[model samples]
Target: MQLNYSIEGGDFTNAGNASSQVKKILKKLNVDPKITRRVVVALYEAEVNVAAHAYRGEIIVDINTERIRVVLKDEGPGIESIENAMTEGFSTASAEVRQMGFGAGMGLPNINKNADELNIKSDVGVGTELEIITKLK
Candidate 1:
């Protein structure tokens, strides 16, 4: 199955909408609980990243018998240094964002930990794209 979702930057109220909907879809499909949990974690973090940093973004999800793949692409000031950005406790979120309790610097790390395969590509002034993959097992 395939699904898509749109996100608006700085929209805290709707930040987790895509993730929540994906979780429901997984549950309805009777996916494994552990896999579902991990997917939710990764998906939520990815969604939040777009909301916290991008001007706008979209999420595309593909699911098959063996694995699930999610692509999150956003229009924003992309990460300057992906290496540094991936570090735990490192973030570029604004003060207002931090004050909202969304940018704790754990988003990427958490997604990395939960996703079986995580790939991120970013352009400094353009945008960022993340691909998170997980096996159904």
Candidate 2:
């Protein structure tokens, strides 16, 4: 199955919408509880990253018997360094975002911990793209 979702940047009110939808779908599909939880965590991180940094974003989720893959593409100021950004407790969230107690810099690290396969690409001035995949088995 495949699903698509759009996200607006800085919209804290709806940050977890896509992740929640995907979680529901996974539950309905009867995916393994462990795998489902991992996917949801990674998806939520990616979704929040987009909302906290970019101007807009879109998520594409593809699921099959063997694995589930989610792609998040966003338009905003891209990451300057993936390595640094992946470090736990490192974040670039704005003051407003920081005040909300959201950006703890754990997004990418948590995603890496959960997703079996992860890939990220960004252009300094353009935007970013994230691919997270987890094995269903």
For residues 25-56, write the lDDT of model 1, one tens digit per residue. 99999999899999998999998899999999
Query: What's the distance in Å from true for residue 65, model 1?
Result: 0.8
What would the per-residue lDDT of candidate 2 be over residues 1-137, giving only the tens digit for each residue? 89999999988788889999999999999998888999999998888888899999999999999999999999999999999999999998878888998789998999999999999999988999999999987
Q: How many pairs in model 1 have backbone atoms within 3 A of each other, for residues 3 or more apart or on separate chains, i.e. clashes? A: 0
Local error of candidate 2 at residue 112 (angstroms):
0.8
Residue 17 of model 2 has an lDDT of: 93
- Model 2 residue pairs with clashes: none
What shift in Å separates residue 35 of candidate 1 from its native position after superposition? 0.5
What is the TM-score of candidate 2? 0.97
The TM-score values for the models, in the order shown, are 0.98, 0.97
Q: After superposition, how far is residue 7 of candidate 1 from its true place, in Å?
A: 0.1
